[model samples]
Target: MRLALVTGASRGIGRATALKLAQQGYRVAVNYRKRAQEAQQVVAAIREQGGDAFAVQADIADEAQVMALFQRLDEEDKPLGVLVNNAGILFTQCRVEDLSAERLQRVFATNVTGAFLCCREAVKRMATQHGGLGGAIINVSSAASRLGAPGEYVDYAASKGAMDALTKGLSLEVAAQGIRVNSVRPGFIYTEMHADGGEPGRVDRVAAMAGAIPMGRGGEAEEIAEAIVWLASEAASYVTGTFIDAAGGR
Candidate 1:
């Protein structure tokens, strides 16, 4: 069976993606940093639905833990066929000039460095010609990367911008080797991260602002998960290095 490794699968888009991939017939390795209970719940839900899934705990920012995650997958005879680098942290809204060094580093550690490390390990095992099997990597970025997030969260935007660049460069570098890299930039999805950011009502606010868009609403986690599932599937065999914007016209 094909295996999918999804970081930050405890909740929100990551959880939704894990469930979606399982539904698509991929045995899922659900990765979570701290919310062990929530992670286990995701696993339970998948099994209840008659899907194959297992929860693996790891802080994606730590290289050793990320390496061990893959090692465990190897031991299970479930070499990764798809990787969703969805584990990320968002800082409280702060202006660029007022950002703290600690806060900045923390964001980068989880949002940027974590994705890099996971992608590195995944590529090591996913290179078409060298690795046993060719696979796909889907980075969950944000539309804020393009919007710049202005007075709200420039640091978060910058980190996702870095992810966007990585997706493009890695896609070109590994396409010939049968590994496709792409990003799903969701615009204003309601997730736990927003609550952590001190604005649990942000999604409602965004929905009001979304009046300018044709769709007239914020995107849903399941909608974004659907796009991610498609990008990781064979249906997107010819697609790579592209950003699928799931923003409702944002």
Candidate 2:
């Protein structure tokens, strides 16, 4: 089975995607930063379902750590076929003017730089030019990039916007090399990430407001995982440099 690595897989959409991919016959590498136990739980769950998975630890924001992460993947001797750049960081809600450089760096370091590092490694292994089979890259972005997250985390939104740009450019750069890059932009999904933004019920709060979400509800991590998995599957063989907005018509 091809190996699928999902960063930040200890929880939320990453965890959901890891589990779903395992069910689809991929050996999952559940990557986490400080959530070893949670990551192990995901691996355990996959095993319970007769699937293959293992937890890997690394801080995607650090260059050395990222290198080590891929080295660990090499020890498994599985040619990585799918890289889900789902690890990201967002600060508490703050207006752009109130945002600090430290916060911006922290956000981008993980959300943008970390993803680029992973893409670099994935391409090296998956590019046909590198004498390996082709593969797919799925970047987990946010609808906030387009929405701007005004009066909230504009910095986080900007970081995701950068991610979108990276997805498009990298897709074109490696398309002919047997690599396909795509992104899934999720909107107002109910996850622990909201708590990071200082609002545990942020999705519900937004959904409660009329017209905030056209679906009159928030989405689930599993729903986002579906979009992500589809983008990585053979079903999307001809799809690249594109986005799947699983935002409930928003």
Candidate 3:
């Protein structure tokens, strides 16, 4: 069976994507930093639907942890066919001047370095040059990358901007090797991530700040999951090095 790894799969977009990919016929490895029980719940839900899934714990920000995560998957003897670099974090509301170096480093550690490390391990297992079958990588970026996220989260925005660059560069680097890399930028999604930013109802509180999304509302995790699943599917066979913005037309 095909295998797919989704970071931060315990909740939010990651959870939704894991479920959707399972529906797409991929045996999922649900990776989470904490919330082991939540991750197990996701695995159980997939299995209940007659799909295969397993939960793995790892803090994507740590190189050693990332290696260990893949090592466990390697033991399974199944070739990885998909990777979703969806694990990320955001600090409370603050301006650049008020942000400290430590905060910046922490944000980039998980949002940027973490994704890079996961991609490196995945390429080793999926690249044809490494004697493995080719696969696809779907990055979970944010509209903040383009919007700059001004007062709220410039650090998070910058991290996503780097992710965007990685998507394009990696896509070209492995195109001939049969790997496709793409990203999805989700706008104001109704996820717990908002609470992580120090506001439980942040999206609802600021949805109008986008001027006006053509769809007239914030997106759902399932909506973004559809794009992620599509990018990992054969339907996107000829598509690579591109991105889909699920930001309600903002």
Q: lDDT per model, in order?
A: 0.91, 0.94, 0.94
Clashing pairs in 1: none
User: How does each model score on TM-score?
Assistant: 0.97, 0.99, 0.98
Question: TM-score rank, highest first?
Answer: 2, 3, 1
Better of 1 and 2 by lDDT: 2
What TM-score does candidate 2 get on C-alpha atoms?
Answer: 0.99
The reply for model 2, stretches above 4 Å from the true place, is none
What clash pairs does model 2 have?
none
Q: 81, model 1: CA deviation in Å?
A: 0.4
Write the number of the candidate with greater TM-score, choosing between 1 and 3. 3
Error of 2 at 105 (Å): 0.6
Residue-level lDDT tens digits of model 2 in 131-194 = 8799999999989899898999899889999999999999999999999999999999988988
- Poorest 10 consecutive residues of model 1 by lDDT? 209-218
Clashes of 3: 0
Give the worst 10-residue stretch by lDDT in candidate 3: 205-214
